[model samples]
Target: MNKLSDEKPNTSGVLSAAARDARMTFGDKAKDQLKEAIEIVNATAKGLGISVGSTATAMLDIHSVAFGSGSISLHDETGIPLRGMGTGSKRLLTAGLHKEASKSKSIALIDEIETGLEPHRIVRFLKSLGSKDAEPTMQVFATSHSPIALQELSFNQVFIVRHDKPGGKTSVLAAPSDAQGALRATSSSFLAKSVLVCEGKTEIGFVRGIDLFRVEVRDKESVDAAGVSLLDCDGGSETRPFERAASFQALGYRVAVFIDNDRPIPEAEATAFVERGGALFHWAEGQSIEDAIICSATGSIVLAILEAAERLNPDDFDLLDSKIKSASGGKLNFEDAKSFAEMDCLSSEQKAWIAKAAGGKKGWFKDIGRMEALAREVVGPRFEDFDEPFKKVLKSIIMWATR
Candidate 1:
């Protein structure tokens, strides 16, 4: 470098006095280059039609570039990086990376396998794990409360842990066979000690309504608090309840069946279920659930129930009237159900026919929500106003729940 500091020209017109005085002694060695750059910039600003009197200034700081790599990252076409990926997507990506990176066998333990995944995605991700061929490639152990995740696994693959308060002991049992569909549909029942396996949505709604009535009017706790959970048989042939009940019983659950009397399950299966400590609850023979409930109602309550059902089925004109008329074999034919109100009253036999029509496939209150509303609005409020036998059957259920 040329040192002409003492004989430097009087170039104060090119720069201010402060700028001239600022460029002093050698700053060791490396800083001399920085000082030269500062002078060059200050000198060039004038030729470039720039003024140096503004608030702008420049300096060098070594510490500022210490962690510069933090700003460096690779991104996808849409400018999203690894940090921008969703948790579920990140997890799947990680699994895929592990699958490709590791050639040797490995063991993986994942907690809450359903975390950050949709139901269908969860199934697909799970199916990707474990053995690829007859010989195992990887082993996986996952914990989850999701029924969808559990449903994809077979019986022996799932283990349930239980605690016995009376004996101060714990037991781990494998899931039971023949219970995949039912167990997955009502997975919460697995946690309960008692399961009242009801036939279809109608029975489920009826029992739910009774539970509500028992709680609201009778001043009792809910069946849920009593460790009793209601299960649906998922509606199949007469043997579905028994098959599911037997499966739950094998899993150490106190099981019961609440079904219609239109078609009885095989006597041998019924006896076997009872012999295995199962409970059976049903209406008198030749009677479905609708028949048993409607035929037992008081005349005023019967009209109230009919009015509620008719109100709920307003879309179908003269619907209940047609069902009632056809159910009675033209003995109770009417232009509209409203005309039935003109009668002094309906006999028990006439109401039974109406009940039969209601239990049909296209009947009123066939849906779970509709049947649930029927119980809550009509049957639940008029609990004692129904026949004694109807009340007795409900009482049996309440006793079992509380016991």
Candidate 2:
């Protein structure tokens, strides 16, 4: 593999003796070729989302020819030197120069290709790397940590680097291209060995919270150490979970679906997922994550969560009583409130209201940042107070991830 790094662009030495000869002889063909080369560089830079001044020029001076004065200097749109341009622009210009100089049968390796580039520019840069009509076919291997770069790549072009913890062996696994279209928003998950497809943001927070707690208090490894990534699937959509799970499964990566019990996976899909060696983790039937947490967690843990919520959003809590009364038509104590909300007697609206109150924007469990802190400080030390089913869920996730 030929590595093409974005080192300092040496414009002076690039002016060859042949060009000086052509200039001295006043040969039309060589001058035309030089002009064509300059045009190609400018065009390629434009395609890579770089703005270059039209004043960019390469002139051969007869008097200073022996001193290597026949050189090219690039400028930005405002006629400023390329050296004075932003890093992203300079990198793009350097890339353009490399592409112009490349042969037909070339394999280019670029490290951190997305560095100093804006997210939107990443797509254009990728497109410019491919072979176009009349251009030589080339292969490009680029490394990037940008999600935008991942989104622009087809799954077949993507590989997840898996490092075995015990053996310290690293392997690269290719992702299938079938899910490329649907994965634009969730492409970052492809980097991990195993993915936990969460139903929504709240579920993401809870899982991350638990992970933080374990790492800080229990002196355990973080989820990242287990090669697990959590993806929020924007909840309540029945097909999204299955689609995402299938995407990862096609890539030969271990995947687990973590959804609310209230959202059931169709039997056929569930069976197919299991048949294909995927794992599924969900709450108890008829319960969302909030319900499960409330019903299963120890009373002290529940009180702590509530008290923490109150502390975080005092004004929101002040309005909670009136809102609860309007939704439930009666005042209920915190101990019985969640259970009552979970019962079959409540209407859909009432259930939604309860859900909002439990995990909405201003709800106790809604702030992922605070939840992370809580997990580290409070939940981590008292993790045993979490209900058995919740504990089982955590264990299952860890087991699946490590395996």
Candidate 3:
């Protein structure tokens, strides 16, 4: 079977039928192939538990494997194209299968788990290695050069495969037990996505909050619950963060560096560094992630509520005005303040008016933990969650900014 498989394979990049036919392959066919791949991997690696299953292909346009000029994609059973899957989603599914097999005391194995994934998505893949719901009681092993994957997996879990120089024998090198040491050594080896450089705990706190609010976020529940590892590369200056990002990028992450706009280096220079060397995503102009939240009544919270109300009901500017007056201290325009001062500037009547217009008490400031929450309710019921809904807004912003 191996010989036949190798013989039939196209060695060169002549664009094999698999790539061309991938677009036409239906879900059932893809599922069978995936299942076969998983089974074969399982057979090769004993002890480590592995399982496989199929998910109903949702949107296939993203997954179609195209050959000619345009790209092709895989399709589902319905002849609909297969959709693209993220590293996180794929890992989740993979972990789920392994979990099920573990429940049945089955052996686990996976050949190439990094297929069809984005670099940013590797964090998710590494996180799934330690899933709590369906953990591999035995062992888990995979072959991947993805730095994100390496960084995300436990040091103990890492095994470097190499050929014995003299004997021509295959050998494996276990990563150092000391995590910091292993990470330091590996940082020089991989290409990281983005390095988040922050001032201190506060900066770390802010970045972490922002990450949570991100639409395509690393799954904290799975990562933390299952003991999946993540690198918290925190530092004060661009020097360390930049250094770490470079090191990790060399090892292989689409590295982005996150730093406060108020850091020592000029904002322009810092931004330029990030743009040129590292990919950095920061808070909206003059606004930090902390400002994203709206308090219930005091401070910037009301301003946030007012902003949401205004955006959703742009036609009712007068209504917004009245609410601003009611909430303001001296009937000031709620939009005047650059920050939360707008809330204090208004009177109670304006506050109540704006809140009432938004959907009454339950309408405006219903949830106050994050500003994204307020932004969503104002936008529409469709955007209930802050991250999912806010991501669309961010994408639009990115497009606009680039243009």
Q: Top model by lDDT, which number?
A: 1
Model 1 C-alpha RMSD vs. true structure (Å) is 14.2
lDDT per prediction? 0.70, 0.67, 0.43
| Order of the predicted models by lDDT, top scorer first | 1, 2, 3
TM-scores for the candidates: 0.73, 0.70, 0.29
Model 3 lDDT per residue over 76-120, tens place: 335443233344454555564455455444545656656666665
Model 2 clashing residue pairs (backbone): none
lDDT of 1 by residue, 148-263 (tens): 77666766677777789999999987777777766677777776779999988988888787677768787888888999988988678888889889888877888899988888
Q: Model 3 residue 361 lDDT?
A: 29
Clash total of candidate 2: 0
Give every collision pair in model 1.
Answer: none
What total of clashing residue pairs does each candidate reach? Answer: 0, 0, 57
